[model samples]
Target: MATLNKGILGGFSGKVGTVVGANWRGLDIIRSRPKNAKRNPTEKQLEQQMKFKLAVSFLQPLKTIQSMYFGSGSGVKSRVNMAVSYTINEAIQVVVGLPELIYNKVLITRGELTSFQNAVLTTQPGGVLHLEWEDNSTQGNAAPADLVSIVCYCEELKNWEIFEGIVMRSDLMADVTLPAYCLGKTMEVYAFLNNVKQTAASTSFYLGQHLVN
Candidate 1:
């Protein structure tokens, strides 16, 4: 790699013949194109690719939820990108040489707002999702008025039900009714808390997956 002592296009950006031209630091430069290797990927690379695929496929349906609950990323990265990276690195596992998602290790959101305590979920008839959590509003940056969010995913259908329940942190229990279409589908449920201002949210809690009645 070399610097281009000219404009961005002075050295060109594509390959011509055996050489590649590009601009760097306001300078035009020329370099030879490296030969391509037909070698197979290393074991580590294969594992990384598998984990990335798992994370992406599992998270794609929740892009809107991630954008709202995930971290506020920096520079060119958005919240969804950060969420995917986190899932790839932290929530994926190698079981019997196959990549699998460790659902409990996944975080839908992470922030200073205190997370739910002893959170639990129950599936009721008619897509009614009963969520119960001990109030932790006295801890960290949590507040009694903090809003709660429920993120439900149906793996078989690759569908999502993002519900901003009207319950607050002070509410020890709340029932969220999913759409009629989700009544019989198995859903992975997670809950989190966000400040009333919607400026911050707590780490999400995985309440386990169940067949919605």
Candidate 2:
């Protein structure tokens, strides 16, 4: 009988191929020695089952080793590493939150206010709420603090309500601290972006950073 060599065994990798070879060998044994075979069909079936089961049992440890590289072995570790990389990248999202507004009817167009050319809304703490664009001259041509209007909004009794108004330029960014009081068990809290200009003015909300909690 030609023995299974190290080179041939390497190809098994503890998959279906290992059982296939064992099944073939068991069939050959039965065919070559039929006179002293098991008495019934069920016994012959059991013999075949035992052959495959023994093959699997012998390869179980090798299966564990191979699976660690390709499958579930290090899923948690890889995910943790990815989370750490994101934290190190400092890709956090920040927003200045809604501006202050006394009335709900007023609207501020993104075109009229020219300091911060772009605005991003986010859910991070201690992050910049606003940014401004400047010409290459490094000279600021912005209006006074009283001239810039920030329209703010808050939720009241399940309705969008206008809050106070503020005159601000670059110095009026507000940090929305985490709510100190928990009202009750709730799925989500509601807030609104009031007085957002409809024409040529747009604000984008997105997932900025991937961080580990």
Candidate 3:
């Protein structure tokens, strides 16, 4: 119950007489070890701890992306706090819809299409993916040459397949061949466009998930 101010022993580690020294929150302190409690944690308390552990494990890998888009000039601690809060509030089972960070601008995460319209996906023989979309080049934000980026995730394999290429705005269709192993496994697809000249990117569109056939 005593706060050891710095000027005292200047942070002693190990046991010194009856006092044990340690560092906590960047501060040096000394305290006596308390006796272990006899009662175990309740079920609800254990569940809460499990949720926290899950959140940390889930968000650890996305540290780079979260810092890129949601840092907001704050340190990594801020982003971690946000991710933890979101995970707890929503009880997120799968991680998706992370916002894209481009040219210091944050774009929407939910993948709402704008310049591209009527996107459709169909599975062809041999597990080929046929993607078709209407070209709305007349949109003010549209450009003559844009880069299309597609990301698909195979939950069964815990793998992500990315495809990106420069395409003329007039083109309305594209195709991708799923790996033989990915056939018949449900996969989620997301598509977005990047205007390289302007260094801007469009909001991603979630094309939904289905078996590749």
Clashing residue pairs, backbone N/CA/C < 3 A, model 3: 111-204
Where model 2 places Cα greater than 4 Å from the true spot, the runs are 1-115, 125-142, 146-158, 161-163, 177-213
User: What lDDT does each candidate get?
Assistant: 0.83, 0.27, 0.61
lDDT tens digits, residues 1-213, model 2?
333434664322222322322235433211222244555668546544544443333223323222322122245544223322222222222224212222222212212223343333333433212322223122233333322222222223222111222323333343333232212211111111112221121111121221111
Candidate 3 local lDDT, 29-121, one digit each (tens): 779876668999896676667666756654564454344333243554664576565555554432242221121121222221245688887
Error of 2 at 118 (Å): 2.3
TM-score of 3: 0.57
Cα displacement (angstroms), candidate 2, residue 43, comes to: 78
Candidate order by decreasing TM-score: 1, 3, 2
Q: Cα RMSD to native, each candidate? A: 8.1, 22.3, 9.8
TM agreement with the true structure for every prediction: 0.74, 0.22, 0.57
Clash counts for the predictions, in order: 6, 6, 1
Measured by TM-score, the strongest candidate is 1
Task: Give the winner by lDDT: 1 or 2.
Answer: 1
Q: Which has the greatest lDDT? A: 1
